[model samples]
Structures are given as structure tokens and as C-alpha cells.
Target: MVGNRSCRIAASAGLFVVLAGTAGCGDEPATQIAAGSGTTTTSGAHWQRLPDAPLSPRASSVMVSSGTEVLVIGGQDTAPCPPGADCAPGRITRDGAALDLTTRTWRTIAPAPRPLLGEQAVVIDGVVHVLAQNHGPDGYDKPARLLSYDVATDQWREAAAPANSIGAALTSSGAKLLAYETSHEQGLVPDRILDGGTWRDLPRDPLAPSFDRVMVAVGDERLILFAHELVTNPGADKPSIVQAAEYDLAKQTWRRLPDSEIIGGWYWSHTDGLLVDPSIGGADGGQTGNYGRVYPEGGIFDPRARQWRPLPALPAEPSDDLWQGPATGGPELAIVRGFVLDPGAGKDGRWIRLPQPVRGAAEDPAAAWVGDRLVAFGGTVHTDRKSAFTADTWMWQQ
Candidate 1:
């Protein structure tokens, strides 16, 4: 989480074009590192490096596609922590920018009245709606204010705040937006329905106190929220951040799902259900440990069928670095950062390695599928909480 005071954006607004080659995400899925081995090719697609955006690079920002452009919104990065502190405090901004898909040009968008961050963003109709942190951590769990942006007018307007949504998350369901906390952080906060500009509280349901936070994804008429589950053990705390719940958006009701088959596995939502990487190792091989594993041998959940399915084994191993982007579902499903899991490609489905970017992605850039092209904007690398952000935009033209 970022501190309340907004900080200065690192760079000035300018658009510069550059072309470069060679990039690597250490120990990642065959990022074309070796002489011939890393250079594996996929047909009819290549990566085009576009002009750097008009804003300084940042991570955890929300990027959404609005047909004509890709808008990159609020993000945070920390300052260096002292020698003994557990972590450093970061800064969040209300700043935003947009890139024209056709012109490949970048322009600044109006910033929200309040800064925004979190996984609570979803595209509704053609507008992108986000929630702003209404109240700080002042011992009171206050509701977050809802804000919506229009790409056509390049304007932002405030809407009704949801039910105790401070740090709560949201996802889009058809023409409506569903907002709820990942856990019972605000003491049984009710799930919210934002249809049009009005907000309505759904019937409250009891939820676990699993609030450490993860992603919220939309699947069919339901939205699945991923949260951390703290395990109380004798020696040390071995919490798995994979517990989930499903909210039937149509019915406006909540259903607490069962414990994950592979506890602590990384999961993302597919159009059908959830995608899990049940590949974990270390002291607790294939089970819960200190979360010492990174790459996930893909698995999936079928919400309609209420079952889990395993994906084909990855062709190569990946680094300990976490997979950073959102899971994209469709004909070519992208779970891992640079690879697309095409379920119908082969007998068991195969990984299609994307062309490597000169400035590597998957380290927290806002990614979106724009038609046949995949656009990734502004990723950062942090050292001592000192972030080195990249303004470079990479589009995988397929």
C-alpha cells in the first residue's frame, strides 16, 4: 500500500521512438536466452516497440482497453527502506495516460480528483470504472468512492461509494459492475451492485477473514476473488494466498467455495472458471510451504461443472520471479507473462512463446488484449524499494 501524500512523477511528458533488441527475465520460461534454444519462433506474430508514453513508468497501475486506445492509470512505487524495517512505504498517483491504437500515439488523460490503485478496475460498456481510497487506515473501515472515466470526453466523474469498500475490489459482469471486499475486512461488508450510476448493497454473506489480497477476476455471470489464507502453525506462519469465493452477479448472492485442492497455488480466472498453477516445491513439495515456488504447471477450474482440470506441463521451467500480468482468456489464453496457453492448439494444448520485448514485461505492466494485438504498458524493476520504471510500450502483433 502507498502513503497518502502524492509524490512527483519521475519523468516529463514526451514521446520518443526507439528500436532495440535482446531482453531477458532471469530464469523465466525459455525467454530465448540461449543461442538457438531461446530463439523459438511462433508464426505470423512479432513484437513492435512503440513510442514511450507521455508519463513516467509505474507498477500496479490499471490499464484498460477502450477500442481506440489503451489507458494506463494510477500506480505506486516505494522509497528505499531503512536497514531494519520490514518494508518501505510507496506513493500512489492520480495521474493517467492513453495510447491511440491506430496512430500508435500517446496522450495524457485527466487525473481523477483522488488517486487510485488496486485490483478493483473493470471495463463496463466502453467506460473504465475504478474505486478511489476514500479513507485512510485510521482505525475505521470507510467506503471507497467510485469513479468512472470516459475515453471519448477524456473526463472522469465521481459516482456513489459502495458498501464499506475501502481496499475492497470489483469486477465487471455484463453491463453491471460488482464490488466486494476480498474478505470480511470491514466487518461483513456487503457486496455492491453498481448498475448505471447508482450503488445498491447486496444481501450480506459471512466471509472468512482472509484479507491479505490478490486478484479479482470475472468469469461468466460470477466473479471470483483470490485472497490469502493465514495458517497458524507452531513454528512459523505458512499462509496460502489462494482461497477464493464466488459471487453470482446475476443473483446478487455469494457462495464460499471449498479450499483449493492444491493449497497456496496461484490461480487466475478463465472465461469458464479459474486457472491454477498447482506446481509448488521446496520443504512442502506440491503442498503448502513458505511459497518458495514460482512457475505454475497450469490447472483450471470449471465453474459450471464444479471441477478442476490440469493443463499440459510447461515445456521449460521458470524463474522464482512471480508472474506479473493478469490472466487473459479467449482463443489464446495467456496465464504466464510471455506465453499464451492455447487449449485447442494441440492434444494437451501447448505454450506459444511470445516475442521477447527489448524491455521485458510481466514485472507489473498493465496488459490488455486489443483485438489480435496484445499491448503492455510501463513495467518497473525495484531495487531497495528504488524503482526503475520503463515507459516503453510493447505490442505483440499477432
Candidate 2:
């Protein structure tokens, strides 16, 4: 959790924006972006709409950047099933394509040589790096290997494999792409994979914990990773984030940032950093130098105050028609489990809400901030089978 002082800073009038990119989260798939005053309220905010991406629905695919283009990669497309009917098998994307924000075009490129899910990607020193599983048993219980994609030449090559199965969640921070694996070694000890191919021991979390989550770059060198503990069976209380933490690559340290302090309440599923729309506070904003702030659904986390303030309650659960079909699962489906925070305004970090919502998106869907848009590709969602995978891609711009 943020220190009491940081909470105070966040509670005060600091700038923030809610950024997301996805659609069809459920039946009533509507995207809304509102501009508001310093006071956080729906009415006080203004909504603006933008064009949407032209990609088929998919989940668990990789979304990352190669300099200017936002690349949407491999994911499964499983649709067309009646309510309560089992979903069809999942599909894997063989290649990738980039969306040029400058000209507003989609250019499809070479497909991934090995089609697989539960992998992660990042760009370091201009090289597109991927850590993913192979098409064999090694994928079942072992660590994934590393692969690098050269955006300039459009080529893929094998790098180093991690010591353990590189879990589905991965992010780039400082000079490394942090890879987290929560499974046990030999079903006994806990371990972590970092920088794509390195391994280290992670402290056992006493609270609800799982490696299937995401860590996003916040300020210049800081990242806040959201980790969740999901229950196989839902009860009176739903599953939620048992713990949250912030990492400073420069200092190479881990510090806990509680959801309550950063989000006012518990951030249900995901989080992101947004540059406060200057319109909110203008020059009257809380802090001066830093305009970016983190907002997690269920509430907003004020880094200046190091505190959290709740946002308006999410739209009431959509109707059953929007809820039924392959997307529906247990009653627990009403609760949100995935989201994206985008820097739509770009350079100045003018953050806006991307009006797309993927139903039951994986907490760690491959996401990237390319130019002025944020793209989310492939993620797991609730299926008739209780939990199914998706290969859908969604994009939003400020």
C-alpha cells in the first residue's frame, strides 16, 4: 500500500484519467469518455467518441509496440454459441499486423512461427522480445523459451529459455522485462522468471496471490503490478486483490501499495497510469511537474496523496442477453476481472478512456501504448466451461 503520506497526496486535488481499450465486454458494450472538473463525477465529465480498430474478436494474443506501430498478435476467436451452449474450440493467430496511427491503417505482417498462448512480449533496445510456450508438454508444466522479433526486418529468432515456465504475465520496466510465475517447482518451492530468461526466488505472499496478472510502467522508472487471488468457486464474497506492490527499477526494490490507499477501495481487477486531462484542474491542479496518475477501477489511486478515491459505481451489470451466450458463466460474472488504462492523448500523456471492453479479459492481457492509442490483445475470459480463452483485439485512442 502507498505510505500514509502518499495516500494524502492522492486524496488531494491531483490530476488523473481513466484509460481503457476494448469492446464487447458484455451485452451493453458502450464506450464512454467524459471530461470532468476536479471533482470526479459522471455528469461533470464530458464524453468523446473515436474510431475503433478493425480486428476480429480474440483473447490471449500478444499486443506490444515496434517503435511507432501498435502490433496485435496471436489470439483465439471462439464465437457463435447459444446461451448455456459450450463454446467452440479456440483459434490461434499465426502472424501479426500493425496499426499506423499517423495514417490510420492496418498492415498485416508475418505470423508467429510457433502458435501458442500464455506468452508475453516487450520491446527493448528496439528488439521485439517474446517469452512463450512451445506446442508440447514442456508447455504444460515447464518454463517458456525466449524469442526475439526484429520489427525493422520482420523476422523471429530464438533466444534463451527461462529456468521455469514463464507465466502468462510479463511487462517491461527499466532495462528488464519482468516475468512472473507463481507455480511451484517440483510442486514444492515458489519461483519467479525475470528479464525474459532469468530466474529468482520470490517471497511467498501471505495474502491472495497468483502470477496471472500485469505490471505497468507508471512514471519514468516506476511500475505498479496488480496481483489477484481468484477462487474456483464463488461465495458470499467474491475474489479480489489480496495485495498490491510498486517497483522502482532504478532502486531495484519492491514496496507494497495497498489498493485502499491507492484506490480508495479495493481495485477489483486491473490498473493503469493516466496523465490527468489538464481540463480537470488546469494550472490549479495539485502537483505541477508530474501530471500523470494511476486509476484502478472500483476507484482511483492518487499517487500525490498516496490515497484512493472511489469512482462512480460501474454501470449496473448488463442484461442477461448481453450476459448469456459463450460469455456467461457463474453468477460471479457480474464482477469485473480485467481492464486497460490508456494514455490516449500521447506525448503529453493526455489519458482518456478507450470505450472497448473484452468480456472476462485476462488480468494480464498483452497490452501496449503505441503512439496515441493503447491496444489490448488476447486474454482468458469466463466461458460456458466456466473459464474459456479469447483471441479478440480491441483498440482506443484519445
For all predicted structures, in order, the TM-scores are 0.69, 0.54
Compared with the true structure, all predictions reach lDDT values of 0.54, 0.43
Quote the positional error of residue 205 for candidate 1 in Å.
Answer: 5.1
> Backbone collision count in every prediction?
2, 47
Which candidate gets the maximum TM-score versus the true structure?
1
TM-score of 1: 0.69
TM-score of 2: 0.54
> What is candidate 1's lDDT per residue for 1-398, written digit by digit as tens?
21111121121111111112224322122232221133444365566667777776566677777767888887764442333445533677678888998888889999976766544466766788887774334523555677888878878888767756665676666676777665554455666777656777766443355554434445557666555543343112332334556777668677876644333333354532344442322122223333444322235555555555556555544432323344554324444544555543434455555435444323456667665566776655544545455566777654
Cα deviation at 250, candidate 2, in Å, is 4.3
